[model samples]
Target chain A: MRSVVIAFIAGTLFGLGLTISRMIDPAKVLGFLDVAGEWDASLALVMVAALVVMSLAYRLAAGRSAPFFAEKFQVPTRRDITSRLVGGAALFGIGWGLVGLCPGPAISGLGLGLPQLAQFVLAMLAGMAIHRFWFLRKGSH
Target chain B: MHNFTPYSALIGGALIGLAAALMLLLSGRIAGVSGIVGSLLRPAWGDWGWRLAFVAGLVVAPLLVQWATDKPVSINIDSNLAVLVSAGLLVGFGTSLGSGCTSGHGVCGISRLSPRSILATVVFMAAGAATVYVMRHVVG
Candidate 1:
């Protein structure tokens, strides 16, 4: 099978998982984030389950010489803790807190044909484009 | 909270983990939604196809879910248009600058035991919690 096909299947599974778990719901995520308010602790269960499976699976994959379909695993190797990382996460957190929608859920929200989701996605794309343009101009990326 | 869904969350999360694991095993990709989307923004040679397919899959998954389970895809937006736009821009810029989001840093990176990802997750979660605190408590 082709990598694109595999990627699509993986994405489908991911989206389905999010939907079934109601992770697609912003209010639920906000509830999870809201420790001070009426907090919903169910999202933590999701994280724990996912983490357990992923950690075990990753350890197995890490030992393999190569992936079944691809030549090598392209894992993140950068280990630096730059200000950009912290600052970017802070901004992302603020946006998430405000709307309870992160990139994954936001993209999945596109399937619903809601104008509001479109608005959020377009603004997000513009933000990404602006950052890309700045980096290109500086020739630093 | 009106809806409590621990069983769904656990099953859903296990499914997500399986998906990520399959991506690693079969395609050598990190199954990070933001990272995949970000790469498509500035595509290298021969890097556009899989990313496009992945995004297409994302866009299609809800329809399939709706069909299979009779569950309408739902969201809550108490914020106005201006607030939504601002939040979108902030999330985009922040994810780009931070180099990952919940999937990349929180799930995949943490699973692999990366120090940078651990630090990133801690910072983002703390900040997210604080912001939520202020938004629900202090401001409103």
Candidate 2:
């Protein structure tokens, strides 16, 4: 119960942050990505500031054996720089550049009652399903 | 740039970071939206509850904010259906293949100094810039 409450509050904060930062606006995202055009360097600060805070959080977590409401801190342990990572990131970037939306922003955007965003979300789910069925099930990892 | 907003950007970013911080310190979970949602596809019986709750909060918060503030969440997306679909497909497929997305790898992973996350961030940022350049310059 505590874990669920914390997750919900964290998610709410995240959604609010995305909204206030205008990261949910696809046009703004594209502008940030469009380095050749009138480059909006605003979004870079989002990453920088997020990094700063998360870094501190990581430091705090390092001192503790477990989370307040959970058994252990679930962090990714993979260290290899694999082809799959690079390839998939590149493809994801292409998609991001194409639509100027990511999973977080895109999912949050659904609340605004945008038909186009709904279509994108549906297609995104389909794509995930496809990957799950084809790549994941086939032991592609 | 007319749309440049450093103050809001930083504040919003800090809030996002705080959110991640809460998740890590309280729930011992990474606040990576893509990873969270992806895992739901094959949820362990005991693990899906928080994920669903988190997603519900994410999807509902904006509505609550709009109601409270009378300021709807601002959003502008591509009008073309086909392009939107294609972009969505690529995003979903790629994020799955990569094992993370912006929040996962970009914010959480990079902050922890994960080599893979750093490399992934660089690759995706470069790819995004290059794609934008190509679409606006070469194609347009």
Candidate 3:
């Protein structure tokens, strides 16, 4: 119960951060990507600030043997750079460039009452479902 | 530089970090939005509640901000339905295959100094930049 509450609060904060930063705006994101033409590196500054704080926070979190409400910290252990990793990232990048709406901003935009964003999200859901179906059929993780 | 927002960007980023930190400290989670959504797509018995709550929180954020500041969050996107649909599909497929997105790989994974995350971020960022250049420059 408490875990759920905490998750909700965390999510709210994350969404708020994205909103206040104007990252939910595709034009802002596109500007950041426009390195050769009127580039805006402000978002990079955001990422840098986030990285610094998260690194410190991670150090503190690691010191604790267990979480406050959970028994263990769930961390990804895989370190290999598989083909899927690179290829999929490339695909994701293309998609991000095409629409300038990564998952975080897109999901955050759900309540923003935008028809274009709504269409993107619905298509995203469809893509997720299709990917899952294809993965199950292949059974080759 | 007209749209530059360094102060808000940094402050909002800090808050995001704080949120990620809070989630990790309190619940032992990475606050990976994509992973969270993926879990909800095929939910486990003990997992659905928190996952749903988190998504609900995400969905409610704009409303909260509007109520608090009396401002509508602006969203700029490609208006072409074909582009939007294709972009959404690719994002879904790619994030799933890569196993993370900006939140997971960009924030949490990179902060941990994981090699995979580093490479993935570099690849994606470069690819995104290249795609933008091609679309706006080479073809334009």
Candidate 4:
């Protein structure tokens, strides 16, 4: 129960961060990506600030044995690049470029209830389901 | 070169960092959205609370910000349904294949200096940049 509350608070903070950082705006994202043409460095600054905070947090957390709410850190063991990775990256790139919105911003953008974002989120979930059941299944067998 | 204070960006980044750290400290979780959502799909005992709360918080936080700041965002994606759907599927596929998303690997994992996450983040960012180039310049 407490963990859930904490998760909600954490998620809220994250979403708020995205909103305030102007990351939810596709134009800003595109501007940041337009390095050769215009070179909007706002997003870079955001990234740098994010990295600094994350570094400090990591430094503090590294000393701890266990998390406050959960049991252990849920890190993945697999490290090699596979077909799923290559294919997924292609898809993510296409989606992000077309819309200038990735999962984090897409999910956070839900607050605005735009139809396009809704479509993106739904399609994203459907894709996830299809990959988990169809593609991964075939690969494993 | 530009005179940008980065006040909002800094505060926001700090909040996110603090949240990620707190989640680790309290829940021992990595604050990965894909993992949290994936866990919800195949939920085990005592897993529902954090995932649900995390998702809920994501939904509500913006509303609070909008209310407070009066600077609600408006998104304009000029793509057809087919394009949007394909893109979503791709991200979904990518998240699963990579074992995490930007939040999981790019932000949190890289913070911990995990090698796998570093590779994954590089691939993800490169893929995104390449896609944007192809779509905007080449295809158009």
At residue B103, candidate 1 shows an lDDT of 87
Error of 2 at B68 (Å): 2.7
lDDT of 3 by residue, A55-120 (tens): 998898879998889999988889888999998889889888887888888888888778888888
Q: Per-residue error at B57 for model 3, in Å?
A: 1.5
User: Cα lDDT of model 2 overall?
Assistant: 0.88
Tens digit of per-residue lDDT, candidate 2, span A1-141:
888889889989998888888898888899999998999988899988899999999999999999988889899999998888998999899999998988998887787899988898888888777888897678775
TM-scores, chain A, per candidate = 0.95, 0.96, 0.96, 0.86
**Model 1, docking class:** medium
Q: Write the per-residue lDDT of candidate 3 for residues B25-54, one digit (tens) a residue.
A: 888898888788877777478889888788
Query: Model 2 over residues B1-140: C-alpha lDDT tens digits?
Result: 87799998999899899999999989889999988888888747798888988888788868877999987677876449888899889999999888889999999999999999999999888988898898889997
Better of 1 and 4 by TM-score: 1
Best by lDDT: 2
Error of 3 at B130 (Å): 1.0
Q: Model 4 clash pairs?
A: A68-B25, A68-B26, A69-B26, A69-B27, A70-B27
Best by DockQ: 2
Interface RMSDs of the predictions, in order, are 1.3, 0.9, 1.1, 2.3
Clashing pairs in 2: none
Give the worst 10-residue stretch by lDDT in candidate 4 chain A: A31-40
B-chain TM-scores per prediction: 0.93, 0.94, 0.94, 0.90
